[model samples]
Target: MGPVPWTVNSEIYPEAYRGLCGGMSATVNWISNLIVAQSFLSIAEATGAGPAFMILVGVAVVAFIFVAVFVPETKGLSFEEVERIWQERPQRNRGVAAVPDQKEPLL
Candidate 1:
């Protein structure tokens, strides 16, 4: 859950910004890894493993909510289509970003 948003960030960014997003995603992953590696033992020591793990579980729940509420569905949409959806203002748009339900290219 901690890293899931970063993975989605890597996947959904438009091509022009994909490289920048990729670097950001990589940075997030590495930073997360470093934090967990450096702090897990201390966290476990300060609070028993049970508590530490529980904290993590709580974090996962929060992350899930954050993703669900804030992240747009991009699984089946093309980058160009997705970009259009996001670039247009909701007030001016009557529909959901013109996002399609396309599963795959017919070709």
Candidate 2:
């Protein structure tokens, strides 16, 4: 996955929803992992794993295409600026804010 939306969303979203989003993201990741773990043997048996691997590759390709075409870059911009850009776009979904920069020295 890329860095843009993840960075943007974490910054701009309400604090309450941030944890929820994070939890959901983690859950989806774990679920996908579980699916892969449980199905790899079966997939290998059914289609020699080549087809299963190819399907994953295809899915990644499609996801990359969608992200490249639709997601905007957020690097080097403030969270608010990223939010403004997201809001201005008609086709884009809301993105998380960039994490705040710390100017004070660490204690």
Candidate 3:
């Protein structure tokens, strides 16, 4: 809904792969926007407004969880530091809890 996605996309990838990853992320973002915009009316009509809104809320919750777990915090960190944080993390522990000096993920 804001610049968070763009800002994160800019900071997260290595310089060499930034362009490719940024384009991919942008494509996915627009596709998701299109899907929701196109389907909201049909979904609401088919299921009623309360249920339709609830479905969107459920999706938002899932997305929040996914971001909290998988997205690294780049605040106050240099590009190399961000990369290092991700690289130092174990595959099994990619969540915010595993991030250095952070006990809780930003919400």
TM-score to native of every candidate shown? 0.73, 0.63, 0.77
lDDT of 2: 0.68
* Candidate 1 residue runs with Cα over 4 Å from true position: 2-10, 89-107
> Which run of 10 residues does model 3 get worst, by summed lDDT?
90-99
Residue 81 in model 3: shift from native, Å? 0.7
Name the better of 1 and 3 by TM-score: 3
Per-residue error at 104 for model 2, in Å? Answer: 51
* Model 2 steric clash pairs: 8-96, 8-97, 9-95, 9-96, 10-96, 11-97, 12-97
Which portions of model 2 show Cα errors greater than 4 Å? 1-16, 90-107
Compute the lDDT of residue 101 as modeled in candidate 1.
51
Report the C-alpha lDDT of model 1 over 1-107, residue by residue, as the tens digit: 55675668755777888888878878877887788789888999999999988987887798789889867888788878787766764545555656655789766
Model 2: worst 10 consecutive residues (lDDT sum): 90-99
**Tens digits of per-residue lDDT for model 2, 14-66:** 45577787767666667777887898788878898789889778877997898
Candidate 2 colliding pairs, count: 7
The sequence of per-residue lDDT tens digits that candidate 3 reaches over residues 24-86 is: 888888888899999999999999999999998998888889889888888888989887776
Off by over 4 Å in 3: 1-3, 90-107
Highest TM-score against the true fold, candidate: 3
Better of 2 and 3 by lDDT: 3
